[model samples]
Target chain A: MRRAVSALLALLIFAYLFGVLLKAPIPGDYRDERYNYYSPLSGREANESVPDHYVERGEEETGSQNIVTSIVVLYRGFDTLGEVTVLFTAATGVAFLLSTQRSKGEKEKKKEPNFMASTGVGLVLPFILLVGAYIFVHGHLTPGGGFPGGAVIATGFVLMLVAYPRFQLREKKVSVVEAFSGLAFAVIGLISLIMGLTFLENYLPKGVAGTLLSAGIIPLIYIAIGFKVGSELSAIVSHMKGGEE
Target chain B: MMANLPFIMVALFIAIGLYAVLFKTNLIKIVMGISIIESAVNLFLIAGGYVKGGIAPIYTSAPEGEEMVLPTPQALTLTAIVIGLATTALLLSFVVLIYRHYGSIDSRKIRGLRE
Candidate 1:
């Protein structure tokens, strides 16, 4: 009965979504006339062309050739900072929830996981860590970013705990990494302020746009983000896996 | 037909994932459904940034100019992937905790945590 109800609900939801999809205007075919009824300024030509100067300067000022990176790190640095903080808060919350000492009965009594799983995870661990670090490091230059890279690196800790149930992470050591990375992140932002720019502003030279070392604080900030994310994730994993057997 | 293949597949995968999430009774399966959705979205995001046969967004030489694939979507997808991992891990941990408490991995039995 529950399955039937759920299936019916799912069907209804999909049908509604399909209806909305059919009614929605396609991106390329977007027209002012379609949205005319919703406009506050009733008869105003309704379609206003945006200025190209900001767009053009954004292409040049941010240093990174990729327009998205330019906008993310330079044009909208504060939003990115907030996003990082959200991740940090989530990690903290997970750690807080999972942080608990093992009871007397559960202490030091570790059950061995399957040998195949252990060996498989062990073999894959380095590659995972490598990819994570690679993603973090190349964030500014490529498609990857600090958050993803950091999470990737932290998976190493999680995998270790899974493969070797006996492995316990010391919260103290992980906390140090977390704290230092966060501090470094704040310091980078402060440096921008000290240089007489707004908070998290790109005070350093916007190097020749498409090169590896081109975006000054862009790379630096991503590195800091990577460190922060890695440590935070590892800490969360440790907290979750550290307790009990 | 070939150009639209990836998008179609991704959309289908996402639909399947959404279907599984709503209908699956097992906690683990629901989590897998969520992961599948994440994967599908990642594929879509990556596909959105694709410039037909373009090189990596980096440039060893400047003369090649600026007609490259948008790196933003890829970066966004990468971030999304990380966030997805964190979410999935947290969800799995919750599932484990829920199982430990209820002695069952069934979602219907775990409704006690809802209120």
Candidate 2:
């Protein structure tokens, strides 16, 4: 049977992975304070890995207190931009696919949600939005960032959609939010380029490291990302739900 | 074997997902399997970057003399998670369309009718 063959194949793959990955060295054994990285450029054993440098010096170099934030928004910002583009493409595809199925969406007799659940969504949405905003705003100093913050805000919208089957997200407003936030990210990058720096390079002064105002363009980029992601996700949800525009 | 517990779990998760993808008949289940595979990959990346007793890579009010975990992997994982979300959404939309046209989500039925 196909199922039997696939199970055997999966088992074989698991065995191969177990053999290879289990033999690899354990990370962070605490026996070594210093990291050992083999650098191909110099063909030498270096005492510090790339991560070690990021941890030790990232704050001073990027003016961001969070090393992860520095890596995501500064060092690998081009990748983040690509990821956002991917999200946007997916959102557009979903909308395009579902937009043609208008007749079915209107015919289903949707049951009205109960009072408690509907009322609770109205009460809880603001706190969710506030937490999402806080997460992206303090991304340079906290564990949360643009993606999670945006997801949280989208969660609020999802809650609303689930509670009220008839609840509609204005498609125009959603697209405008998506467009402007996306433009904000690109505009910041263009500003950096016009200022005689590389694309997306920080143009503003790196303030004191621990403060909310620090990290130069890092927080700004994250804030932009938060808005962009939030709107795109909510738009996708609205499209999928077949809510009236 | 025990020292590699996290890696083993990651591999097992991936294997289970692979099995689902290969063996399942339902389109929706296949999408779930793909999402599971993404989660496993994210787990693998995080496990690879583990530093024992390491705190997050943030420097704001960080404890004195504590080691920080690798930042690059976590950043990469964040990217992966978002991409996974997008892919999952896209996949689900496709599944919905399939169901809409065919009135069923079973692969066997859909495959036979494909011209």
Candidate 3:
């Protein structure tokens, strides 16, 4: 009966998707001469007299070779904060779900797990850690960004836990990393206020574009995101395998 | 034909995943189905960002003002993959906990918890 119900639901979903595929409309932003293009209403342009140099300076103003990073970090920074909060909420939900059913006595057993799987994890974890960190640091200039890089880094712990069933992730390290990274993320945002901009606005010098050290708060935000995601995920994994407690 | 291959592949993967999630009796299989669905979504996203002849998106020693593959979707895919991994791990953990409590991994057998 459960299988049948699931099948019916699946069929419904297929029908919906099929219908959408058949009838999906072209997006309004398509550049076609025939279509009536909605133009943006003229708004108060920033006074050109104050500092015209900032407008002409494209990549140099952000240090990131990728314009997408600038749009995300500098232009739409407030959205990033909301994104972080969504992650935090998901973590909190996982914790709440897992903690409720944990048995009382399971908490007392803190013995270190056998090192059978630890040997293999110990061998490969450093490389994974290194790559994850590299991805986070070079996020602005490279293909990989903060969230993904952090996830890759977090997978190191996942690999360790899976390879060594007896080994548990050190809670102290996880907690410290999470706390500090989250703090740094907030601090970076707050500092934007100090720099005469709104929260998370770019406050640092927009060095030359395509340079390693460009994109004022972009790299910093990526690092913080990497750390935050890595610790949160590892903790989640541990909670999963933590079992009974 | 080749250009649309990725989209077709992603669609099929997602379809199979949805089937598995809906029809499989085991909770673990259902979770696997979800993961497969995530994989399909990620694949589609990455494919959407594909250029006819694009490099790995590194901006070094390239032609001036060259058109590059969209980076936004790649970034979005990374985020999706992370979210999928976290959710999958959590779901699997729940399955494990349920198995411990009921000694059965079958979803129907564990319906006792509902009442």
Top candidate, metric DockQ = 2
Score each candidate by Cα lDDT.
0.68, 0.88, 0.69
lDDT of 3 at A21: 40
CAPRI-style quality class for the chain A–B interface of candidate 1: incorrect
Q: Which residues of candidate 3, in runs, are more than 4 Å off?
A: A1-61, A103-120, A162-166, A243-245, B49-51, B54-57, B113-115
> In candidate 1, what are the lDDT values of residues B1-115, reduced to their tens digit?
4455566566567667877898898999999999998998898777755655555554334335444455567546655766686687678777766765677899778678552
TM-score of 1: 0.73
When only the first chain is scored, the TM-scores of the models are 0.77, 0.90, 0.76
Residue A65 accuracy (lDDT) in model 2 = 89
Clashes of each: 0, 0, 1
- By lDDT, the better pick of 1 and 2 is 2
What's each prediction's TM-score?
Answer: 0.73, 0.93, 0.76
Worst 10 residues of 2 chain A by lDDT: A27-36
| Candidate 3: residue A238 Cα off by (Å) | 1.5
Candidate 1 residue spans exceeding 4 A from truth: A15-59, A65-68, A101-134, A162-165, A208-212, B1-11, B38-57, B60-66, B75-79, B111-115
TM-score of chain A of 1: 0.77
What DockQ would candidate 1 receive versus the native complex? 0.21
Q: Stretches of candidate 2 above 4 Å error?
A: A30-48, A103-106
As for TM-score, the candidate ahead, 1 or 2, is 2
